[model samples]
Target: MRKPAFHRADERRFLDERGSSGPLAPNGLNPATIMEKAVRERIVDSYFYKEQCFGVNEADIVDRVVEHVDFIGGVTGTVQKPTPFLCLAFKLLQLAPGDDVVDEYLRHGGDRFKYLRALAVFYVRLTRPDRDVYARLEPFLEDRRKLRRKGKSGTSLTYMDEFVDDLLTKDRVCSTSLWKMRRRDILEDLEILEPRVSPLGTLEDLLEEEEEEEAMQNGDDANGQGHDGDSDSVRSVSRSRSETRPRSRSKSRSRSGSERERSNHDRMDVDEPGTQRSRGGRSP
Candidate 1:
């Protein structure tokens, strides 16, 4: 048996075909392919250079770490797990913590996702003093905006206030007590924390309840209309019967008047015959 010879056309066909595994072009690069490659290289270089800077005692690495951290922070909405990357960047800048970096993050951090802010809070907690952490992160508890998160089932929205509350009260962005590792232990050994509730799920439940109430109200209105129709039919039937009773009474009165006139005529005829017989007998 002879093996088939690989050709450039075959490689191009393979790259052009879209499937579960991503697109790849060997001979000619599409714009999409080029952009994807560029993004991949940037990510790889960002991590590699940061790691390389970590190995050496370099002071200029702070700028590179900060730039990468800011980039990751800005992309928190798209990236599923940004904390690991952020923690790595924080570790790289551990020796010489820049006040400008912290200030810049604090100023622009509100525009990022809440999880990103939580990760930033974790970084601050680890690096800054306790007083500075309180001073910087406490005001975020008042944020009213929601954070969207993707899960196994679907996407869910949550309040930033709740996340900030957890950070402030528990000294952690998320409750560790509810972790799978903690749950795997004996029930008695486990300290259960309040489960994080998604605002989106709650809103959905409320909307369902509202729809049910509206359906019930509509059913009641339909029943009310049916009852009103029944009442109207009954009233019309009663009115027709009342009108018929008056016509029957008038007919009865007319028949009684005719009977009285006939009796008066018969009495007059009998009196006239009696008077004539009496006059003839007296003359004879």
Candidate 2:
């Protein structure tokens, strides 16, 4: 398979430690060579220097370093090892701080490009404080795009999230209080620093009060219905009694009229004296 563009470009100037023909420094590696004439001339003519009034510009310095690494037969020459041009550029920027240069680099630095992003990260880490570092770099941890890294025998893919993790923890990219601390220690510190009070507590209390009020209103409705039922039952009983009272009075009047008619018939029988005398003569 073909290597990625970045990996191919990165290896273009890598120098192999063994079988190298040159005067060795104390580090047992060949000293870096001067930049190619053409590349040097381009750097001198670049507008980056002109905009800075011939003063030192970090972006221009970084661009020169990248150009030097990419150039054929330039200082570090074409070799087969990892290059330190990025680290050198980072060091140069750190030595001379420039907000305008940093801003320009960040604005132009595409996050998809690992080298450019790495340079931006290094600039932020060296210049910004711990709090700002975490705030700024945390968002990059969510990026999951694959990046290619040259391995000993082959290339391996790594996610951007993993790269960011390495930058933050393994590489100590930012100078925070938890720098070099264990994960457990960091968690403990976070727990201690987090606020104990929650913002939802008041909302919960309000919900509970609303629920209680609903319960009370339901109970009141139930009690009101029960009272109405009792009143209805009492009215029904009184109405039945009132309806039976007129019937009882009519019955008493009919009984008194029958007794008076019986008394009048007995008086008529006593008043018939002629019939009684006729019966007495027949007996003599």
Candidate 3:
């Protein structure tokens, strides 16, 4: 049978259950074009892609990903054996799992089956809209669960949060080229996304606490105590820097001027003795 130029032979809808269409590449790039052509070809030709990745529907694919995927990686070794994670990622591109399936994958393992979650987010990044990608992936920034990732160099430790972050910020991850995503701040400005709240809270608050502690160490007796008593002994020390910054600047400027004058006076005193000694020698 003559195969159509656009679709691959292996890629006819395996079962009526799955509607296999090319990735809904937001930019209209076909699914085959989503991955680099060479990499896509490699994945298609690889033993895993041929054997395991074939004929899987949305439901089966999920099982395959969770049960089979151990280490998250791209191609590893000199022969470039594709990781099961990458193979499944490519499988997702082919099956084109719907939003709900993707969500199921994201929420599926919770902490138990993390690589599945990793694969889901990877697929999401490849397929979803810019705003949705940021909104969905940013929450995982706090996941912090450890992930094992393998590569040409060998396996290394990574975290779920770090992987999610790389998906958002990096141009390439796990050897797959990521589509350019809009900046998070840009989306927030457009009101497409809300600003993400960090788990540790704003950095400014931590700096303020540290500054208060340092100031208290320098002079607790002067600042006095507050409601917390001992804990708030540094309370007065925590006054907004803006209020006292100008006064400190003025004091520093005056001190520098006085030091300069004292240096000049000392120089004059030393020169007077030298001048007297030279004058007596000339008179003799």
Question: Evaluated with TM-score, which candidate comes out highest?
Answer: 3
TM-scores for all candidates: the values are 0.33, 0.34, 0.68
Summarize candidate 1's per-residue lDDT along 1-284 as a digit string, tens digits: 99887433222232244333443222222222322333323433454433543443223433444444322221133442333334343332323335565554555644554444554554454444444555566667667767654332344566667655554555323212211112212322443333334545687798999999999999999999999999999999999999999999999999999999999988877767768889878996
Query: Across residues 204-275, which tens digit of lDDT does each residue of candidate 3 receive?
Result: 988998999988876765555333586654666666666699999999999999999999999877757778
Each prediction's Cα lDDT score? 0.48, 0.48, 0.78
TM-score of 3: 0.68
Best by lDDT: 3
Candidate 1 has its poorest 10 consecutive residues by lDDT at 175-184
Candidate 2 lDDT over residue span 94-179, tens digit each = 23445555555544553424555555555455445454455455666666666554433454567656756665676332121212
Candidate 3's C-alpha runs over 4 A off are 1-23, 219-284
On a 0 to 100 scale, what is the lDDT of residue 144 in model 3?
81
| Pairwise lDDT winner, candidates 2 and 3 | 3
Q: Which of the two candidates, 1 or 3, achieves a greater lDDT against the reference?
A: 3
Q: Candidate 1: misplaced stretches above 4 Å?
A: 1-83, 92-100, 112-116, 128-131, 144-159, 171-284
Full candidate order by lDDT, most accurate first: 3, 2, 1
Clashes of 1: 0
